[model samples]
Target: MKRELVRNREVGIKSGRSASYYFALWSISAKLVMDFFVPARDLNFFVFNGLLVALFLLLRPRLYLGRRGVALFVVASTFFAALALKDGGNSIIFKIASLPVLVVVFFSIGRGLSEAAVKRLFKILFVEFIVCFLLNYVLSVATGLIRSREFWNFEHANLLGSYVLVMLVPTSYLLYQLSNSKGRIIGFVLVLMAYLSTSTGAFLLSLSVFFKAKNLAFKNIMIILLSIIFVIIAGLALLSIADPMTYDKIAAPFKLINSGGWDRLVGEARNGGGITYLAADQQGSFTWRAYAYLVYGFFIAGETWDRFIFGNGVGGYEIVWGGAMPHNDFILILTDFGFLFFIVWVSFCGWLLVKVWREYPQWFAVVVAFIFRLLCENNIYSYYVASIGCVIFSLIFGAITRASRERGAVRAQASRAVA
Candidate 1:
């Protein structure tokens, strides 16, 4: 009777743990799909903020800032936040609050997640992301809501790119770690999907998946070549679907090469005339982005000392620039947090980069992809990108840290046996 009672207790404990685990996963997964329901350009801030609060209360994870150095960071960030409040003040307090909330949540994931759990989360997320993407595209086309073939049922085209990039980059590292045939196939599909999204930044960053060291080996090289071939075919297929004139315009370069129009091609390249004419919508065009960057850069350079170091205060940029983000993470950080806090942020990211690069190259790739994406998109505050990012990084880093400790202990045992 005692044995049976003990067995029941064990089963109950396991079931409770699983319930908690799945709840955590569901909370994070819900962020990715939540915005799809809302038709506006803005995020679902209410739901996102509520979910974060609920997770914090349920998990109650301790915030471990790791060493005295982080104290300075905390102080700097607090100072900036105060400055923000004193200045113009941001309407969205969650933007500022989400950072520390994500930090605490990272500890929660780190404590509970194993390698298998991380992989399971990735698989669930990947499947859902792909399915939703297809549905969004189909629905957009059928409903005649298309904007330059890039926009979909999601928020924006760039956001769509960001979504896929988030999934593709991390999974690239995961696939590299596994090196299974099926995993490689999935990786290729992700690459193609990124290409189809037409978010140039996301597609470019997603290529980091193929940067695995051993992929240069002959067998892996063949796989990459095949993937490239498929990418070309897919691009052509998409253009053809857009209608005949558009298809011919896209394929004109190849036809020009066949006709040996080298002079014409050279002249067009020199003048930046040919493909530049085929740019996306006005907002997605390179000129618009370059102008935005210049304006932000000039503002940062010309700001007063106090404003530069302490920032114009929370929603200062939005107020000054007609409610548009800086669109660059570094600029957003520098402008919002000031130079002092920006230094701390850079230092923290640099430390993580070096740590992961030395100990875990797979995670390193994902981190690089993330940093690269930040160059074009300021998504650190968003629930979809930042929240999901915290879960992934925490799980991978935690599992690897435990594995490293286990390996060190095993080595010590072997050495003692030899003695």
Candidate 2:
């Protein structure tokens, strides 16, 4: 592996110099808005996984995996393929097939993706964000109404939220690294957009960009004042509705908060309550998600031994659950890939988490946000989600590794001069 790394370095195959690298980045970024224009989900699948297949055959980037890594990959892929044969659909099959290609591409990128490349990727995303925001606003004004959850340029509200999250975290981290004041301003715009999109998770995570602001006191005051005003306006709007029963829906979340939190939720699940009480209008999103976790848990527990060990296969969750998905990525993995593959998945993610902690601690918050998104959303099958995330973090790993080596060399030179 070391020899392979050295060989790549000797050949000077920089990521920025490669056309395929840019194509990968562009395809990833383009997927964010492609849904708005095309509205065909399969196109996204093709543009992303198809490109990975092409890259793997053409570029043939080295895997850069250790023995353990290879073992984990082979095991996981075998199970994924097996499950696909048993119960998986084309989406799962293609997604599974793309795993090896993703491995090669991410590994090649993990070797290095230049800062210039990173900047270009985010710049494209930022421009798209601005354009989408403006278009949504103009359309809303012209229509004289905005939906409770605006989809912006995407086909779904949550997809817009996902895109915002993908953009907000890493871009904020990069801006903060440069001590750019402009980040806060841009973050405020994104925060507002998130709120308008009605995605609570994205709205909260977008605030991280302002966490280290120099004028924290002033920002807090302004934020509080704005929030209060927004609440008042929203309350008035609700009150204007002739439906007096709206209060019951408005108070649903408060009821959940006052109820016993985890204990009650788990207890309900154990009692085979299902999600009858946690259904849409009865409770908030958190309570609904809690029920979802328990439902997936019971399903996994009830699986036959063979299915339990190897999983029902990719897309298994929807197939078994009557087209319902486990929105939580961790649960999705357990249910789709089964118990054995989940172990490997956790190990790989743990290794990556440790690497980030050691090499680029500054991006820890961004990683946390990404993890939160994974927990709250179904992302394993989405090509853009995988590409945007892995590419950015790979670049981070490369940047930090190179800088550390350079610093070590400088320290060695200083010590030699002293001697």
Candidate 3:
């Protein structure tokens, strides 16, 4: 593993070279709005990210095609195969648009960074991004350039808030490991402020998930979470009773991410549906919404043999939804490429999850948090999300490789002793 680490340096792979590192840096720089600052499919995304992927692969070509890698290949090939059988410009366009994210997947497979190395990289990005957020907030206030519901350059406040988890989960976990209680508290607060700035349901949900990590005990976390929930409910109840108008104003921010929080509770409809959300909102849960939408879309796409099995290919969801973006990765993926692609990708993701749990049980919580976000968001289609996934998977894969190398070293020592 040390030899691999040295080789990484020989190939110019630094902490700054990681795709996940750039996901944080580029997102922070997004306010500049220049093509150079953009992290999407821009030249910079191509040049630097591509260079990073290239160097890592150059050092360890063997890491390029593990079981997970093969699964992704099968998925990508299925997409192209779907495109070939279908007739539409959108299918071609979708394929082209997805290529950059595919490259991100390559980066993950190319660099099998050990668990410690991955944690270190994540911590560095966490501190740097939080510092930038503080400085940017101050500067934006001074200049009065900050727009309402906008944090940094994210057009959607939820994206900014939830994205902070990419840093927060790892930083908190690291602090817990290092026994730096004060540092952990400060990092949690800073990250929480960034998260609450948007008050997005998904971001809040991610925070709740973070509590279950190894850093915190189950009983303590349950007590803390239950107490918070109780307070929020009591406050809303009192506000509603005391001043309806003031209550509306106070709950306005909360309602932005969700249409109705407490109001729905007070209404008679609460007991009617087991799921409390709008049928359209999937009860403000991406998993529920995606499941509901996909069932409907499958029928809409038709039960024809080929269509049912292979789907209408990429962009077929528009035919089902009248051109609205699916806004759910599962539904969008399943409807576009059908059962084959969806199954392969999900299986690969499941394998990665198991590997993470097996290798670094401490990080299982962090993995769960991000998986929830991925389920709720169209991260599968987002390049930034792809980069985040790539970096995370690399850690587990790297750790696996490290373990294998250690076993081999022990065997070599035994053989030499026998001589």
Find the candidate with the highest TM-score and give its number: 1
* Ranking of candidates on TM-score, top first: 1, 2, 3
How many angstroms is residue 416 displaced in model 1 relative to the true structure, after the best TM-score fit?
Answer: 3.7
Q: Write the per-residue lDDT of candidate 3 for residues 300-343, one digit (tens) a residue.
A: 44557776667666667666645655555666677776787678
lDDT of 1 by residue, 285-322 (tens): 44344445666776787789998987765666774456
- What is the alpha-carbon lDDT for the whole of candidate 1? 0.63
**What is the TM-score of candidate 2?**
0.71
TM-score of each model, in listed order: 0.72, 0.71, 0.61
lDDT of 2 by residue, 120-197 (tens): 555666777678666766675565445554443454566567666766655664576444566666777777877666
The RMSD of every model to the true structure, in order and in angstroms, is 7.1, 7.1, 7.8
Model 2 lDDT, residue 256, Cα: 64
**True lDDT of residue 255, candidate 3:** 52
For model 1, the stretches where C-alpha displacement exceeds 4 angstroms are: 1-20, 39-44, 48-84, 87-89, 149-153, 177-179, 214-284, 319-324, 381-383
- As a whole number from 0 to 100, the lDDT of residue 258 in candidate 1 is 58
Give Cα-based local distance difference scores for all models: 0.63, 0.63, 0.53
Name the better of 2 and 3 by lDDT.
Answer: 2
What's the lDDT for residue 189 in model 1?
74
Candidate 2 deviant stretches above 4 angstroms: 1-25, 49-79, 110-112, 132-155, 211-254, 257-282, 319-321, 409-419
Off by over 4 Å in 3: 1-45, 48-50, 53-116, 132-148, 186-190, 193-199, 208-305, 352-359, 395-419
